[model samples]
Target: MSSHVYVAFDLGAESGRAVAGIYDGQKLELKTLHRFPNTPLRLPDALTWNVLRQYAEILQGIALAV
Candidate 1:
């Protein structure tokens, strides 16, 4: 039998998370690898999300999945 791993990123209204899915011949399993608050960055003129931070966290999650 062979198995494969897949990573998924979930960004919601209040939070973000990285999840891993493992599949073999039959069933699939999901596991949360990392999570972070989806707080926006307040700028002088506008509000923005911390995209770089999210990317870095996603990499961390992928490492965990590996």
Candidate 2:
């Protein structure tokens, strides 16, 4: 038996992406589903992630993976 793993999100401070990996042998095959800009915004000495946009991207990635 074998298993495949799909990553739907990777939100970094400057960037984010969705990656997929196939595990069958000693070597693993990787694939990218989506890559987008994920820069944090700073205003009034506060920083935050665009949660709405991020969630939309994540859903898109999941749809693509499926």
Candidate 3:
């Protein structure tokens, strides 16, 4: 028998998460690998996503998944 792996990213307005799924022919199992806040930065005049931080979180999530 062989197994398969899958990853999913759920990015919402205020938060984000990474999940992993493993399947073996009939059933699937899921696990939450990482979660981080998708907070916006309050700049001098406007709000914006902290993109660098979000990128780092994504990397961390990938690491966890691996």
Candidate 4:
């Protein structure tokens, strides 16, 4: 039998994560590869997501998958 691998990225308002799914022709198994907080910077007038940090987290997730 053969197996298939799949990767998924789940992003939300407060956090994000990377998950891996392994399918063996019948069922699927899921694993959380990485997780990080999606923190927003508070400023005097507005708030914004830490995009750079998020990017780094995404890269880390990919590295883990590799």
Against the correct fold, how does model 4 do in TM-score? 0.81
Model 2 ranges off by over 4 Å: 1-5, 25-27, 41-45
Which candidate number has the best TM-score?
1
Candidate 4, residues 9-49, lDDT tens digits: the string is 88889999999898999999999999999998888999988
In candidate 2, the residue pairs with backbone N, CA or C atoms under 3 Å apart (3 or more residues apart, or in different chains) clash, namely none
True-structure Cα RMSD, model 4:
1.5
Residue-level lDDT of model 2, residues 1-66, one tens digit each, is: 576775657898888899888677566888998998886666798989888888888888888787
Cα-lDDT of candidate 2: 0.81
The 0-to-1 C-alpha lDDT of every candidate, in the order given, reads: 0.87, 0.81, 0.91, 0.90
Report per-prediction Cα RMSD to one decimal. 1.0, 2.5, 1.2, 1.5
User: Deviation in angstroms for 39 in model 4?
Assistant: 1.2
lDDT score, residue 44, model 2?
Answer: 90
lDDT of model 4 at position 29: 98
What is the TM-score (0 to 1) of candidate 1?
0.90
TM per candidate: 0.90, 0.72, 0.85, 0.81
- Candidates ranked by TM-score, best first? 1, 3, 4, 2
Candidate 1: where is the Cα deviation over 4 Å? none
| Model 1 score (lDDT) | 0.87
